[model samples]
Target: MKGQHVTITSEWTPREGERYVLGEGPRFVDGQPLIVDILSGRLIDSDSGRTLIQIDEPLGAVAPLTGRNGWIAAAGTGIALIDPDGVEWLAKPEVSADTPMRMNDGVADPMGRFWAGSMAYDNRPGAGSLYRVGVDRTVDRVLNDLTVPNGPAFSNDGSVMYLADSARGVIFRFDVDTTLGDLGPAVEWVRVEGGSPDGMCVDENDHLWSAVWGGSRIDRYAPDGTRTASVPVPVTQPTAVLITPDKRILVTSASFGFDQPQVDDGAVFVAETTVAAAPAARYGPSN
Candidate 1:
């Protein structure tokens, strides 16, 4: 079946006393989506808006969470192990930071390591960082001093790691040392004009798909970063995206960033395509 984009959730639905501020990290597990509301640190079940789990911190601002066993690797802080009953226990990040939370978009690599990005809380450009956490609890800094470092997704072969710096409006490519859990010097992979790039994913064909926050669209690019096509959306702020295990395109959007009337304007959208999708990667531990 080809990939398709459609809206499955209502626009700006309220959940756990919070409306969708910034939506990122949409992952399909067990036939349902696990999503994070960035401003509130709430992990929600897409089908019901039930607060499945809560991050025990102030403004946790989580995005692109990957689940494995009982753990969730939350963007901004570190890995959060969610017990079977929906309680979260956080594992401290290996990289030290003055800010309370700095992580952004992340995903589990094909080799089972969690790759996430961090940026200065005050939105300082070029002060963000990236890290990799292995299943055995080993954490290593792979990149540093990024301005709004966000999405980190790997190619189908696991040879290339695509990292995006939102403030720079560009996505970069790095040579991945999978066995070492390391990333090499980044080469400019793709650039977008007038739009900030947020979360990203790799399709079955190894194409890079990125969500543009202000651009109201998702873009597909070839491995070398050539623009393939753009998919328009109803909401202006698209925070994260994923291609489901069955190849359905799921998008999480935001209503909080613009205005009050706009706060509930966001919606979780889906689209269908004939193309298939790669299986989602995994993270380790529950807490």
Candidate 2:
């Protein structure tokens, strides 16, 4: 790893009996960094460690990619609009009743399309898939037979997308169409040996920062997937990574169901870095 020494420290810590319970899907909207407590199904304001809204459903991913009226979330088996009024599904998922697929980590492209993935509840192999919801509200299955799908991020120009299949321990890249949300053939990007890649965020310079679940560290990768830097955390599972507006990288950790938890298991951390974040993409009616 070649870079300046970045300072990583805790940003939010739970109370004695509190647990974050799988923190994931972090995004900055209008400068407010919103994070999801996946298990608890709460959208949190990362700045104050407060719950902004509660949706007692399975929250796979939440990002204001549409950049319109309300944020979009993969709630239950489908994606929905969660605003002050209420929640409404834009397009219902076509999952079979017998399948145990649940939505997981996701992101929006520069052209304003939301992409999310799913995985089986029991980590069943080949029971998950990746879906791309276009700005015009059309849902298309981009990839299938995935396991533990996560980290669907893109470069600023939308010419490249980085996706991770956690169960396979690999992150793959695809050439992308920024406007139509088309994915090209997949190619190997990187492989995390010590842990699985969870959520990721791309910086303004096009470098990818990946959170390694169960590895207690976040590694920075160049556009070519070469590791350039890393920041270690105190907990075992760092689930997601986000770059704030001010260039501070914020990390989400988990301690949800552990019998014995580490002190920082449920705490969120921030790293002081010199890289700026790529501007968040908006999802709306493609005009």
Model 2 Cα lDDT, one tens digit per residue, 121-197:
88888888888887777778889878898889898888999999989989999999765677899998898989999
Report residue 130 deviation for candidate 2 (angstroms).
Answer: 0.7
Q: Report the lDDT tens digits of candidate 1 across residue range 43-157.
A: 7777688876666542232322345345455544665555566645455562376664556777777776777777676887667778777777576767877888777888887
Task: Give me the candidate number with maximum TM-score.
Answer: 2
Off by over 4 Å in 2: 1-18, 65-67, 94-97
- Give the Å error, residue 223, model 2: 0.9
Clashes of 1: 24
Model 1, C-alpha of 263: deviation from truth (Å): 7.1
Worst 10 residues of 2 by lDDT: 9-18
Give residue 128's error in model 1 in angstroms.
1.2
Model 1 scores a TM of 0.83
